[model samples]
Target: MMLYIIDSIRTNNFHGEQMMGKIRTLWENASRKLEHHQNNVYGVYNDYESDYRGDYSLSIAMEENNGEAFIEITSSEKYKVFQVDKTDEQGMFKTWSKIWKQEEIGLLERAYTYDFEKYGPNGEIEIHIGAV
Candidate 1:
């Protein structure tokens, strides 16, 4: 089994609408064998801060002759893409908003291969977000 944790920072549509909506494209890999779903973060807010943090933790149970699964994280806004490696045992990929230079809100991600012996308990990855 493999798990992909996608974290989306404070996001809003052009009309300034504030809500957490699932982006279908990101789950393209598991579309065929998607066994179950667990939406960790949905319809949330952070009025106290300038940004919001939301995550979609999808779990894919292994099947017979399965190759591999992938995790894709994207934003409707324009921003750059930076690489934030995992710095702790949590395997968190951190992102910053201010660094984005394009129309896309930057994405920082890290992936782990499932090795039950090494990674243990169905490879799980964490993502961390911060202000730009």
Candidate 2:
């Protein structure tokens, strides 16, 4: 299924610890602003270039009509989804790390265009990794 999103680039070139910091900051700011929309918040990883050092754009977006005003409206292709229950306070980074590990173990090849997180009104979340 296609997802319509409104997004912004929260970083340029960053990796390792620096990248993690940027991700955290981006989420913190975005999450606060998105609180008004409740469960409509979504995060996207957009890579413009092929290399690891290339530009990495992290965006926190909301689906159309989900509430917050947006800068860009974009659409995503089909994805291979992984659902995780936020039963504990394990945090988003660890959850994402687990998802990436799954990706590494032949879950699916990343499409590299974009990958997104879908937040439920409840405590659950779905990581929608774009797949070829």
Task: Please give each candidate's TM-score.
Answer: 0.20, 0.67
Backbone clash tally for model 2?
0
Q: Write the per-residue lDDT of candidate 1 for residues 8-50, one digit (tens) a residue.
A: 2333323323322432343354444444433332111122222
| Number of clashes recorded per candidate | 10, 0
Q: For candidate 1, which ten residues in a row score worst on lDDT?
A: 111-120
Best of the candidates, TM-score: 2
Backbone clash pairs for candidate 2 read none
| Model 2 alpha-carbon drift over 4 Å, by segment | 1-7, 10-17, 51-55, 65-76
- Whole-model alpha-carbon lDDT for candidate 1: 0.29
Best by lDDT: 2
lDDT of each: 0.29, 0.63
